[model samples]
Target: MLSLLGLLCLLHGIWAAPGDLHSLCYDFTVIFKPVIQQWSCEVQGKVDEKSFLYYNCDIKEVKPSGLLGKEIQRTNTWEEQNEMLMDVIDVFKQQLPEVEPKNYTIRGPLTLQGRMSCQCEANGLSNGSWRFSFNGQIFLLFDSKKRKWTVVHSGARLMEKTWVNDRDVTEFFRKISVGDCRRWLENFLVHWDKMLETTGPPTVVPNAFHAKATTIGPRLWTLLVILTISVLLGT
Candidate 1:
């Protein structure tokens, strides 16, 4: 039937959506806490094979991005963003020393949604936490079927990762690497990537509940029996 066909098509379409992200890199969301209570970042949107575009978010800043710098193990507070900013600029100056520290505001609250977790080197990993910054707090939500990458994870399959908890958020950074701007960013993002895994929305099949009126119903059953008898007699 047309109705059944349409229903099938709708389900198929939702399943076929394209966004399959690998857990390699990341994008970040930075906030000017307390007074402004706003956060934004430089990276956003679907990333190409080579690099990622900038995007931002307005979610809980439960943890800092670790994009600009690694958060040290201490009491967390809103006042630290500016200090983090200064430290980041110092690292930045070391790398591209010619670049002066200017107040660069975050772009906007983008929807670069992905798994929210961390992969620290202290877990007995080989490399130090200095390899994934260029792609910090930024990873794509990829669709395996279509091979397309998207920034937002609204309908896409996600890793069941949540940043709601402070413990999980703290793991996002280790060592507070002011080592170098580029390498430091990579280190933070790599751990974030490791934290990304398939936490699903749980796939389910579509089905029709009621196809038609049942003959077992009193009125319908009587009508069918009478019609059958009449047909038999007439025949």
Candidate 2:
């Protein structure tokens, strides 16, 4: 089984950048079992390598994490940003089942991980991308410039086809990644320096796992089995 800690390590490796590159990234993980009717989700936001905000599905609220988060909450656009994130969660919840593999029987829960990032270089260049993973293995990537979906794992081919053909869904992803994400990053950058001055060194905890090894929920064990089936069947 791929532990939550391992999954976070994978994400950090993908988002790691040079000193001059700044990024605003959101990491979302959702786990659910239709059988038991139990589900949970977590959304985390980071600027560069520092985590600033977190949302818990259990509470349906966004909470500021540190000094940077407090400052961000004070901004006039914070409310709007919060609402946008909530909407994103709602969309994901609605869409995930639409792409689920047909005639595939799973013994346990399902895990879906999604990441959206907007990157800015010191030279005024900017770009954005979205990635989705089923059970910890990345299966889909979005190219903002080309407006296309790249399927990494064949199991996700259906997902890519469905999303690419749905103009509304594709445009929604584009607008958030290319437009709103960039604007939010720029706004956050305005307060970046001052906030850093008052805070400690940047600590990147993509999700709740920060230690070498930690206990995770039972549902996480389903990841490896599902991943294996996904790879073999190309669902």
Candidate 3:
């Protein structure tokens, strides 16, 4: 009886603990290629619920021998992280023109330092389903009502949602394969450049690399997992 009680307690504690991530770090450098002029921007950020969230944006060689950069630091709760990232991006958008207005240069091989958290339950949309695609190479169809996470590429399935832990979800992410992701990256940049050139560039081009979109690569995708519940038990 004592053993049974202890086992139950252990199971509850595990479920109550925070999912893998305490902080998330993203760092990448992009070199936009153009004939007349070129642009290179490096964005780095560290975000967490308890610690200070920091973002550094660096624009190098906007003009011959010119450099521009900005840094932001703030602390926020886990629930606030999604909004925090948007605010940082907005700040970068506002600052890009100061560096240089005319140039098209972008390259990837972006990086993520820690686990990325996604919450399916937060949407409050009962039984909603969404298609998750990465550069059109990898796809996941998540059925919130059914609590099903499917791997479109491999035809693998996580049959039970509550029983699914970080390790189980992470394995599904790996099945998409890193090679496919690299191909996606190359294909995406080609189309992206064409759109930019034709559409006359966006209002602000900071050479931004979105962590969620870029997660097709092994380095980034490996860190992806949905934290089903908030951190109820402190580690």
Q: Which candidate number maximizes lDDT?
A: 2
**Candidate 2: 10-residue stretch with minimal lDDT:** 210-219
How do these models rank on lDDT, best leading? 2, 3, 1
TM-score of each: 0.20, 0.74, 0.20
TM-score of 2: 0.74
How much is 85 displaced in model 3, in angstroms? 5.7
Q: List the pairs of residues colliding in candidate 3.
A: 31-105, 31-106, 31-107, 32-104, 32-105, 32-106, 33-105
Candidate 3, 1-235: lDDT as tens digits? 2222222223222322223222223332333333434443443433222222333345322111101011121112222433434443443333223222123133332221112222211112112233432222333455434555666644222222222455554343332122222222223222322323333322432234422333243332222211211222222
Q: Write the per-residue lDDT of candidate 1 for residues 28-126, one digit (tens) a residue.
A: 333322234443433321211223223233332323333222222122422343344334333322322111113324443322222212121222121
lDDT of 1 at 210: 21
| Residue 3, model 2, lDDT | 30
lDDT of each residue in 158-187, candidate 2, tens digit only: 788778899988888888888888777767
How many clashes does each candidate structure show, in the order listed? 28, 0, 7
Which parts of model 3 have CA positions greater than 4 angstroms off? 1-125, 155-235
CA error at residue 123 for candidate 3, angstroms: 18
Where is model 1 poorest over a 10-residue stretch in terms of lDDT? Answer: 126-135
lDDT of candidate 2 at residue 80, scale 0 to 100: 83
